[model samples]
Target: MVIATGTLLLALPVASETGQPVKIVDALFTATSATCVTGLITVDTPTTYSLFGEIVIMALIQTGGLGFMTLSTLVALLLGKRITLKERLVMQEALNQLTVEGVVRLSRYVLFFTFLTEGLGALLLGLRFSRDMPPGQAFYFGVFHAVSAFCNAGFSLFSANLMDYRGDLLVNLVITALIILGGLGFSVVADVYTKRSWQRLSLHSKIVIRTTMWLIIIGTLMFLALEYTNSKSLAPLPLGEKVLASYFQAVTPRTAGFNTLNIGDLRPVTLLLIIILMFIGASPGSTGGGIKTSTFTTIAVAVWSIIQGKCDIEIFGRRLPRGTVLKALAVASVSLLLVVTVTGIMLVTEQEEMEIILFEVVSAFGTVGLSAGLTPQLTVAGKLLITATMYSGRVGPLTLAFAIAQRLGRQGIKHYPEEGVIIG
Candidate 1:
């Protein structure tokens, strides 16, 4: 569904002011980048694409961020049609619903919650934007950015992204709010809305909430402390501005590409911190992509258990299932391998600094979109590689692997014994 939608959008006829056709490769690349929410672009989006093209791209980003199934389900509900059991099952899987019976209700809630939060975010952003832009343009910019931030789509009309508004408290707060809500998995958000308390939350919600808070707090402090004296970026800012910038940067890296400062100017330690946050990405069943906060938490718990010589992994005073722990480890391992391989390929194909290339590659694979200014100079091969990385990041490496596994195997009763080799 994603590939088809992206391809069709790319194939749509777009022309310059003189009626010349836009290059097909550029269209394809941009379509893939936006639909996958990777944010790597060969050409500057605001300058290269016509207004119509920009709208089309934005629509695609929203659709892709909200899964095709979810959008179709909403349309079905709007048309007053009853969804079938089979359809509900698919929707349940697509939205990662806990059960099949509540699929319709869950879908409705998801849609409502998404729009409500986005609307509020847009209003706040628009109020701030009016200080610099006309009311009409400000409103549109606010709506566009709200949608983009919540979707984790990373598409921006501003050439420098949110850097110009770094010190604007209203803009920073609005964008950060959108990013946080988007990064929290839909399931967690739904739980919050329905339950309204930490005690009443599901185990998944508990894990996501704790993991997200920890990452943000630790990440912000690390960036601030590491980059405080770096002359290129953070040093010159006033203390208050530096704190705001640090927090914004910390929040943006978790699978939302909007930047408040020059990424290329960041100190190495800050870059490393950002990379870690990007690798963690957003939670499951959300607009953002990564191994997910729950997965990260599960892995951490498992590691802690092993280090403490305990057998079972426990968190929030509850023991996680063995299968869950294993799955988390598997996803993390696969994601790491994908990032390393893609980074190596980019190094060979693009003559850029190691930090920049690594940042680009990891950002692409994590769907974080925090580039170090190396995106525009990528070769054709490099672009294609990134396109693939973005797709995998969005769909998930483990999910794709499972799809391939199903094709290669039937029900199997045979098992191979596992063996341990070397210690770390």
Candidate 2:
């Protein structure tokens, strides 16, 4: 529903002041990108899309980031209607809640939390934007950017993204804050608000919080060390500016695409770092995509357990469930396979370099939006591949494939025993 509505909006004359009709494929592509919160674009957004078009894109990003089911629940609440049990089940799935019983309350919390964070983020960003833009325009820019940042959607009205204000402390802080809040997973935020103590938080919340903090800190340091003296981009910057730039770049790739540095100018090592970050992505139940941080953490723990010759994975004094570890492995393996296959196809169809194709594939799968300056140059086939990748990344490949492939069948009586395999 979100995709269709967004596509229609993109096609409508009201969305663009240019008076030129956008091609259907382009419209569909843009809509899918916006609705999936992936920032790949065939056309330059700021130049091709007028203010009206920008607003439509922003709306689509908002709805997509929040999930369509959450938006529907909000509307139902606004109309003073009761949410049915069936609707609650759907909401549970949409929000990735533990159970369907308290979906009504969960929906309310989601809406409330979203508005609160976005509102605060806008106020901070608006104060900074007022220095350059007129009050009204600044306010609009602030609101749009705040929502985009919080959603980790990576769509920006400014043609240069955050590059123009790369060293601006206020801009850096505000945008990073929004991105962190959005990528931290709503459930973690909710738990922090309700529990008011770290020790009282659930296991999921603990893992997410710990993993996110570690990633941000380690990522920031690694980026600073790797790029500080690189002549292409970071070398000329002052100490403080370099640190700030590194921090921003570090945070941006955890599924947010805003860049303070020229992506194409980065060292190969920095690009590799970005690929790892994008692959891990934001926490589960967050607006961002990729395999997710929890999955990464689980995989890491599982690997450690194997190295220690342990039969079971454990973390933070708790035994990890077998099913959880299996799921994480499955998700990571599938994500990697998808990226490799898509990258290979792109390489054959497009004449771009391996680096560019790999970057595009990772960007699509991660929904990270960072590019090797090749997004606008993609051929029709490349664009379609990216669109499919973005959709699969957002909906999840396994779920979407299963939904299409599912069939009713009787259980087989025969059972096969597990067999030992050759070790490496």
Candidate 3:
């Protein structure tokens, strides 16, 4: 519904650069990108969109970021409407929570913290943006970027996308912090809000925070090491700029989508690393999308347990349910299948290089908008393929699988014995 409305609004003449009706396809693509919080674009946002159109896109980004149900719940709360049991269940599904308990309060926290975070980020960025543009324009730029970064939407009014400010430590750090906070997931945010002690944090929250920190550190180090001598990438930059750009590179690929350097100029190995990061994108119930950090860790821990000859996986001193292990495997399998199928289709329809094809596929499936500058040149079929991939990424492959799968009758009378089927 959000995408559809955005499409309609964007197709109007008021949204276009020349006061002409925009192409439906382009408008639909942009709307999907914004609503999916995917940054893929066929048209440059700042140049093609009027102020009203820009506002519409920002609204879509926020709506998509908070989620439709969350917004609805917030509205109902504001209006003093009693939330029913059914509404609570829907909120659970929307937020990917394990239970309905405290959902209303969580929803409240989600909205409150979201606005508060974005407001503070905007103020910090506005101070920086004011150095370049007029006060009003600077403030608008700050607000747009704050929402975009916090939402992990990656939409930027600048055609160059922070490349001009690549060396600005303040801008780099602020955006990085917003992206990390947004991608860490609301559950973690609320956990920190209600409980300040790491030991008191839930296992899930602890895992998320720890994993996020490790990823950032590892990614930053890997990027710096790999691109240290790449003339088109890091070699030309000053020491400070290179470090900052590398840090930004690490944070952005965790599904934030902003870029301080030329994505196309990165080393092939660096691109492969980004693909891995994109596939493991943001934590559960976060504005960002991917298979999720929890899913990835669950799979990893399960494998390590098997290698250790343990019958069950353990984390943070608690046994992880067997069902969770199965679910993690299911999510990983489905995600791989989706990426493979979409990449195959794109390979057939597009003439881009393998790196471009792979990068775009992972980017779409992860809802990470960073591209190798291939999005604008996509054929109609390629665009449609990517559009579907973005929607799937945001909804999650496992969730989409459940939506399409049919329940089957169980074989009650028959019994089968477990047997070893394969060896590595």
Candidate whose lDDT is highest: 3
Tens digits of lDDT, candidate 2, 40-115: 7777787777788888888888988999899999999999999988888778778877567777787788889899
Q: What TM-score against the true fold does each predicted structure earn?
A: 0.93, 0.95, 0.96
Tell me the spans in candidate 1 whose CA falls farther than 4 Å from its real position.
Answer: 1-19, 398-422
Model 1 RMSD in Å is 2.6
Clashing pairs in 1: none
lDDT tens readout by residue for model 3, 185-295: 998899997899988999999889888898889999999999999999999989988899999999998897999998998889999999999999999889998888888
Span of 10 residues, lowest total lDDT, candidate 1: 11-20
lDDT of 1 by residue, 173-286 (tens): 888888899889788887898899889999999988988998989888988999999998889999999999999998888888999889988887678888888888999888
Of 1 and 3, which scores higher on lDDT? 3
Index of the highest-TM-score prediction? 3
Q: List the residue pairs that clash in candidate 2.
A: none
Worst ten in a row by lDDT for model 2: 401-410
